[model samples]
Target: MFTNKGKDVVEGSSSASATDHRQQKQASQPAPLSRYESQKRRDWNTFGQYLRNQRPPVALSQSNSNHVLDFLRYLDQFGKTKVHLQGCVFFGQPEPPGPCTCPLRQAWGSLDALIGRLRAAYEENGGLPETNPFASGAIRVYLREVRDSQAKARGIPYKKKKKKRKLMKANLDNNPNISLQQS
Candidate 1:
């Protein structure tokens, strides 16, 4: 029962009308990101940059390492693309709350692409792409052509196979009864 508005709290409102009102109220309230969660994201961004600038990528848990690399990749990509690229380092975490939000990978890709475009523009305007750290090795390449190229030059990761164990010649010589198998 209502007194201030002088209207029945429930009986006065039709069931369908009440449902519509409830839906509208729910729709208007924006979901908020919590402070702790916001701080975590900020920390992640900071940590990402730290990992990226590292000349030698530090040994870390797979997920943490990947996260940092992803962030670094994004930063390098972002720096190249964003205009007024003057700073050697970006030092601050973003404000905890902002309208902008993106998945870590998506952010990385967007930033990388943006950097690529910026790098191209810089070169077009007579700026040297070679000087930019983010410039891909392929961009700096002067080679005309090659049949097969080494992956090492391109910074690709690979695993080397273990060498097969070899039997000692002395051991073979000592064992007269043992015949060597066909090679």
Candidate 2:
């Protein structure tokens, strides 16, 4: 004869057996998770990993020396694997080259070297446009070079004129309270 398992469900004769059957049925029933739900769970787990600083592998190409340096600069500027999606950086270069992978603290000491190299390159070449903030005095120097080159090519002489601004020099030695009209 069948027995009731606590609630009004049919089960085997022994109470223990009845409870076991009920448990088996419950366990056999499929979990109410859908495909979308399962995928969402997986996605959440992966995203969590990313948020926790576990990034996926990135393949990089080391074609140009400049590219390698720029990658290092990018890492120094931004302290993470993924730089914020800014327009300037996007057009500048794509990431991960040579041995470098993750972002690093800005190499403050390298700033002087970088600036010096930039200046030297500009001195060797003409220079970059003034629009480039990195141009430094390179723009003015380049213009001077261009002017000099033009003068040389044309076999014309150019002279630098010094414009002296007459300073109403302050007589600080005299009392400031004394009127200039008295002088």
Candidate 3:
């Protein structure tokens, strides 16, 4: 009888310890935020607000490529370009008049980064990665066209920077006529 009682106590203690371990594990783990979560949340909220203010109301998830492109164009209206940055000195007493009063255009890099964030946000909000509107080829092509057109309009080179070739000492030794000029 004593042996049986002792066995029962041992089982009860073991079960209690198991429960305690589970509780401890649950308590120790911290809830983590989703990837690019904050930016995604902000982009969604901004898009939501834009949709709300449209002539005919549109749902955020119902947005198409055109709507996304239009949203980017809208952002470009207020974006500050490099020229605007160059003219503005924040520390000056009484900001200079006519300090780039023109509304800034969005650069290619900024738009690309924004689109990436939006794509991540869409997936996080339960939109499937495969079917994500932001990840569509049409959207990417449209952005490329936009960037190219914008660069042309601004008279800026649309081509990416070419990597400079490094001249090796062996090459220089082979061609004695070649000489390095100090700038």
Candidate 4:
């Protein structure tokens, strides 16, 4: 009874376990998706759905930055963050003492992150990077505007921290003015 691992799918009462028996018969499979890949797939599906909802429906091949921008704006209606309009009294307040008539909207950070995922998904799904709506200059400028507006509304400046440069020892050795000192 123990020797028939693949040849028989007959009754089994062995301690090898039912799940184990199935695993032994199966071949090696591809690796599971990473979190980034999963998110990209979800974002891609969502963008496709949005395109389908457009008037007369837009195909992925024909969609452009304008559609992407419109989609982002459409998503603002379902946002959780409270972004006040210019006319609102709490426009520049970090936190208003009381809730007003201001509408809640998505944060600029969230929108930016969503765009990054969608951009990767677009290329992964056979889209040309140069022609990708998510990677367009219009989308970039729109994101920047959102960041600036959100920062101003929240009374905090949004700053992108620059990466620090590492000094290479090969360059130091080539230069005569700079010397390593042993204290």
Candidate 5:
């Protein structure tokens, strides 16, 4: 170190300059969006576009579950997944032998995922968590209805697969020493 009157300078300032460069780089560029965040932004923009296309241009503040339901129905027009009706020959079959006149609607899983993204986006965009339209009971009921109808129409039963732990527990109940019998 050398001192010129009251000013002192370090012999090696590479580390200091490197840190400064890092700070400047960080300040110049924003962080990249994660997959989920990108999806949320897209969903929010889509909802905003839907609102703008409304008859009177609905505001985000005035949006409700009803508007969400309408948007969901509107999306049905673009769905590519086929959901068989009860009267269809392929109803209740996992794989249809031949194509029928079944209607194409948005898959239940896709709608569920979209609703999840929209719900998160609504809160992230300054909407009150309590007043979030996506959090309404109507939205839940609509999702449930969509899930059930889609399940029935597609003949895919909506049953959760049981975990192996539950089966192990059942075996443990039948034999008190089962837990200690592991080799």
Candidate 6:
């Protein structure tokens, strides 16, 4: 009976210590920042600054889809096409190198990813998911229109690569019946 009681006491103390240690550890560490949080913050700041320079300054929360559209269009003005980037790399010259076959517009995939990141950042920064302007149907439709227009202009279809299936390896040693085949 005494031995059992001692064991219970030891177990109780160890568990208590463990709980205390966990609490302490949790208190000491800060929560991890969301992915691309810094980049999102920088983008927001740049947009905010742009707004401030306008005739009438606008806050990020109060801005509508039109403002977002304008911002995206503004980004397009500075975008370099893959061909342009290649020229810059090959010639070791800055952008505005000799023109090439590709259009000057940004790639649909890159713009889509940027929008996704912005949407996530908007939600993370206290914007409601349902009302997020970045994730609005209008924005999606605009992107689709842009993509279609660019594809039509360039005569190239935009295609995303499909994820490859992972091969499952069987434990041949444990399952003696399984035979390894060399292809």
* Candidate No. with top TM-score: 4
Error of 3 at 147 (Å): 2.4
Quantify all predictions' global Cα lDDT against the true fold.
Answer: 0.42, 0.41, 0.71, 0.86, 0.88, 0.70
- The runs of at least 3 residues in candidate 2 whose Cα sits more than 4 Å from the true structure, single-residue gaps closed, are 1-72, 75-106, 128-133, 136-183
Which candidate leads the pack in lDDT?
5
Q: Give the TM-score (vs. native) of candidate 5.
A: 0.73
lDDT of 3: 0.71
Per-model TM-score, in order, reads 0.19, 0.20, 0.54, 0.76, 0.73, 0.55
lDDT of 4: 0.86
The residue ranges of model 1 lying beyond 4 angstroms of the native Cα positions read 1-11, 15-31, 34-61, 64-67, 80-183
Per candidate, the number of residue pairs that clash is: 1, 0, 0, 0, 0, 0
Which residue pairs in candidate 5 collide?
A: none
Which regions of candidate 6 fall more than 4 Å away from where they truly are? 1-35, 82-103, 158-183
lDDT of candidate 5 over 19-61, digit per residue (tens): 8999999999989999999999998999899999999999999
Those runs of model 5 whose alpha carbons end farther than 4 Å from true positions after fitting are 1-26, 160-183
Tens-digit lDDT track for model 2 on 1-183? 543455564434467897899999999999887765554454334323433442333222111223323433443555433322223233223332333233344333343344344444433334344423234464345345534543443344568886442333345335466444542
The best-first sequence of candidates by lDDT reads: 5, 4, 3, 6, 1, 2
Positional deviation of 79 in candidate 3, in angstroms? Answer: 0.9
**Candidate 6 similarity to native, TM-score:** 0.55
Clashes of 3: 0
117-157 per-residue lDDT for model 4 (tens digits): 99988888889988999999999999999889888887888
